[model samples]
Target: MGETIRREWRVEGMDCAACVASVTRAVERLPGVSQVEVNLMAERLTVSLAPGASVAAVEQEVAALGYQAAPLPAPDAAGSAAVPGAAGPDRSEAGGHGHAHGGHADDPAEAGKPWWRTGKAMLVWALGGLVGGAYLLSFILPQGQHWLFLAATLLALIPFGRRAIALARAGSPFSIETLMCTAALGAVVIGAAEEAAIVVLLFAVGELLENVAAGRARAGIRALAGLMPRTALRRRADGTTETVPADRLAVGDLVRIRPGDRVPCDGSIEEGRSALDESPVTGESVPVARGPGEAVLAGAINTEGVLHVRVTRAAADNTVARIIRLVEEATASRAPTHRFVEHFSAWWTPGAMLVSALVILLGPLLLGWDWQTGLYRGLAVLLIACPCALVISVPAAMASGLSAGARRGLLVKGGAALEAIGAARTIAFDKTGTLTEGRPRVTRIIAAEGAAETEVLALAAAAEAGSAHPLARAVAAAAAARGIAIPPASGAGAEAGRAVLATVAGRRVAVGSPRYGAEAARGGLGKLAAAMETLQGEGNTVSVVLADGAAIGLLAFRDEPRPDAAAGIAALAALGVRAVMLTGDNARTGAAVGGALGLEVKAGLLPDDKLREIAALRGAGPVVMVGDGINDAPALAAASVGVAMGGGTDVALEAADAAVLKDRVTGVAELMALSRATLANVRQNVAVAVGLKVAFLATTLAGLTGLWPAILADTGASVLVTLNALRLLGWTPRL
Candidate 1:
């Protein structure tokens, strides 16, 4: 193999999976082209070319298939290179086959334009007028009716004939265009010119409707790209400010965000505090308080105070950009069901054509039918045999599902992960960050007998004030929360993993583990030892406060569960998915958190142990692993679907198959629900697509339907499946 380069192009006029297949087949036939992938929803074509091949060849081949292709800038190019709906020339004006035909092409430039303004809509209208005029003339001049109808049919077949020939040359001989053209021409040959004209008009209208429905499904992703503001208020070094393009904003640039304005880039607050509504990026319903030093994502609304933010990322690398890229790129990762449907469609069209041939040749001999009747019924079967609906069913649902998930901050990598998540029977979660707050918090404070709780807490807080350990911070925070202030402390010193000693109000104070406190307390802990044991048994980290060698109090701390952890677990249970926690923490600590959330605990597991647990769970059924740490990566990859919390480390995000940007445990259940709904939608689409074809094929063979009704059934099935798949764009989890 020679050096290979991967190239991407924005392919316009692709409205369904058959278009994708057509482009793929054309490009794959190019010499030295190793791989070709087309994303129908994103309208993108990606190809891997060896040294001998060129991008020009790939683009030329796609254009020959009735679609327009333009080379995208390299991924590392400056600015937002691949933002969806980026400005480009109209596809129809770019000198290719621009008109819509049966499953052939659509004007992507007309995405947001009104129906009447699109070229496809115009074609439909013109064809409709011609057909209606011919029908009306047939009533007045019966003598010239055949000639008028023939003129209408010939005029309508112009574009379809061109596209059908192009597709046949591109290795797709049985495309919907070919079927429509063949059926209409065969009708005209059999003296069915009137029905042929009407059939051709209906086919054009069907393609126009499919284009409209496809545009609606794509609207969500386009809306995401629209969230990015076009400009930013960049602050100058001399205390002045100037407006600049948001895409030009660089790292470390300070941008001033006014109240009710969206953030232009991902950055940290530097000058002022504010409440930021991050619903646009994270789908978080509530506005969160952000102050100096807190990070803000691009596209979040600054709802309250003005803020001067120091940009931490360039415009193209912001959160919103990554999401848009994720959604567009997701189309490449096809689901198993999608692949199966494509495979079935590949053979379905050819088989239908063969059966249509057999019908045309054998019917006159076996069924005692005349040549005209046999030919008419065979053409009707050929029209019904076009696999447009079956081919489009899976991908349309997948695209709509992914777009909907992105809007809610649930970024499923692709249809594969989306499908696997729905069938998951067990969900394994990491304990530290996934289920709990992952930081120690003060939970209880018990004072020794005869000693005031305030005095004991004050002494402990003063001693811990000089220490920066997590437990010390928890102690100080607990005291501050209760309005207890720490006094002056001096000679602060610590023994690693044992104790911190200091002088508070001229009394020697020590805050340390129970063992260290017992050694310092000359009078012994007395009944405080039992309380310490109980706290430790309950998974709390107990710290003893000793004043002048006498035990004063006991402080119990633990990493508490997140606010919605229980609710998330309960929601999974409601969906028939069992939730379990897998952690490296001790059994006691794991049980403490898991018991609170009512989840099964698998504690003291190493990374390898977690992988083994995942493998074992897979035996019962598909397992989904949700985690946010490096240790969980192995298990994540081993599970059926891996979900990373968006706030997790880069390794976790890269390893997982999906991400919940809101960092809420409840998002897991929401993801599962969305997946189940999407798969259900796919099933509905496939059933409709195949059921209609079967019913129509039967009727055509029974001599009950002819060319016009057959074409109508085929076109209607395509439109129906597309509209059905579009329903997923509005899907929301019931939980």
Candidate 2:
């Protein structure tokens, strides 16, 4: 048996893809490092070391490269392992994958089990006590409800408060429990126990709310990951299928998929094909056909016909597998601002508690105020300082925004990304899959002078019908859809990719992936520009036309149009963004999708071209890039803002700022709506937090305010802010 050693480290300053790669390569280059994966998206790097190597040494090595690596953020600090009665971890940060550092997952849970502290039973008990305690105080005694509530509150607080006071006394008061102590003790001392109990009780409620929201926000990714095919049908020399672990699958492995089964990983068909339901990955309702040599994705369903795929990528690194990884990574990564907030509360809550105590004590001693008055005033200050508004606001709003986006088919990976989108005003759309349907479909066939549209299409269809290229599929489908009767397709003489050169009913024709199709077209490249310009307006791909080796007509095809595309783009524009289309397709196809969606179009772009274009667009303003699956991965990573269809591949989503969980184009619009609303709520919460403080300070200095009022105002503000943030949960953009 091999000896295994693992360690956790907080990796820092790696905010880019290159940074991630650098860390990975540096660690892997080390003498004993077997595998080093730096998840910049999760802000953590895990490296498998040989028997004698230390993770700390690797951390130092990465640090030498100017990337910081330290012990992973504590469960109580950040990263995974759940925080409760405090702000929960960002969705991405709370899971297996995140930007935060990591702990050995196989190690024992920090508190014996993740549930020991954050479990539903503890949550229910802790929260129910607060509520039940608050309720008892509020109704049990009218004349001294405050006193009754104070007693109930103190009893509740004592169990937790003593520890907080001790921690604060020990110079570690800034924590969820300490904050509770300060608020509860202040209320009891100042004769405003009801408010204090209410504050703690409501804070508990917010914790419960946090629990529910966290579960919902995380459920989407978990569900997606869980949906992966559990087993694959391995093809053996006997030609029989046997069940096998998907991980054991390798390139060129023969696998079978039947009706209602997902294609196991991305592969090219070597044997059979079918009409596949790629709706899970493409967001298109229509099932698409696949034939010999066509690549099939892991998560796509085979609606009809059997498929024997020769795997192209290993199951672990398959399209769907990578997509899930990306989603997890994106979710785990936190934004710069979120970190600031997390750290801010990690220190602020306790400081306020101390200030409140001084107000209670020093006020009476220095100013000759009544002990009761000073005590009451101190309690008020403590209530105000609970930070219910601050702690709950950011993550709550994020959770709601994420859930809302997911419902609309958009997947926002983390709190930071969700927050970032609200600030993006310019959106760049990838023409192929993001805006136009990625698959090429024939929309129009143009005839040369004196040639009939039907005649031209029939010729191409008949010629292409014998070919297996996409252009052939489009030509055949178009001819059939238009009710044109095609002569039977003949097996052409020539190797595949050269040209399916054949004569259909005595008319010479050819169709191929590239030049062969062009050679068969009559007009050659001369009519290419004019033909493209005309067809581009219709948002379709245009292939060349040839008749007896002279270019004669133009063939136009388009990717499927997203159902809510025009409306989604319009909605984006309404949000004050300009839409631009970028694609790897030829200029004709690019122009076609761009013109239809009214976006500025750039065609024939390589990944680098897409990056440069996005850079230029960002020079004008922040840009939102929307795409689907992995082809859009690079541009999605490059844009000022990246969005992916949730139904698409996870890699694009990992590279994106947001994912349309429902994979509906309109989800992008809804994401904006939710984001704007969340920002508004955050602003309102800040106002409430600061405004109450101003009033409390002024009243205290004037010698007109006491503990009871301060407690009420502060506690009330906390609840109010929490309520406001929750409003985002219900937000909708009429579109």
Q: Name the top lDDT candidate.
A: 1
TM-scores, in order shown? 0.85, 0.57
lDDT of candidate 1?
A: 0.82
Q: Which candidate is the best by TM-score?
A: 1
| Decoy 2 TM-score against native | 0.57
lDDT for 716 in candidate 1 is 86
Model 1, residue 89: distance off in Å is: 8.3
Give the clashing pairs for model 1.
Answer: none
Q: Candidate 2 — which residues are off by over 4 angstroms?
A: 1-172, 182-213, 229-258, 261-283, 299-321, 336-351, 354-358, 361-369, 403-417, 429-568, 581-596, 600-620, 625-638, 642-734
Taken over the whole model, the C-alpha lDDT of each candidate is 0.82, 0.60
lDDT of 2 by residue, 1-735 (tens): 467555555454332232343456567766777756554333557667678776667866665454446565333221122111111222332222211111111111221233224332353466467657556655765676665566666565654554344334434434445545665675555556655666655544444443333333344444454445767898998999899866567677799888889876788888776898775654445777889988777778898887888888775566555555555555445555545665676556567767878977898899888987777666556555655445444544554455444433456676676676788777777665567555567777776676678877887777766554445677787888889998765655644324456687766665432344454544455645576667655555666555567655677776776767888888888887677777666665566566667767787666787889989887876677887756677777787667876454445445566776455667777777777776776667767766776787678646687544554454455555545655655565675
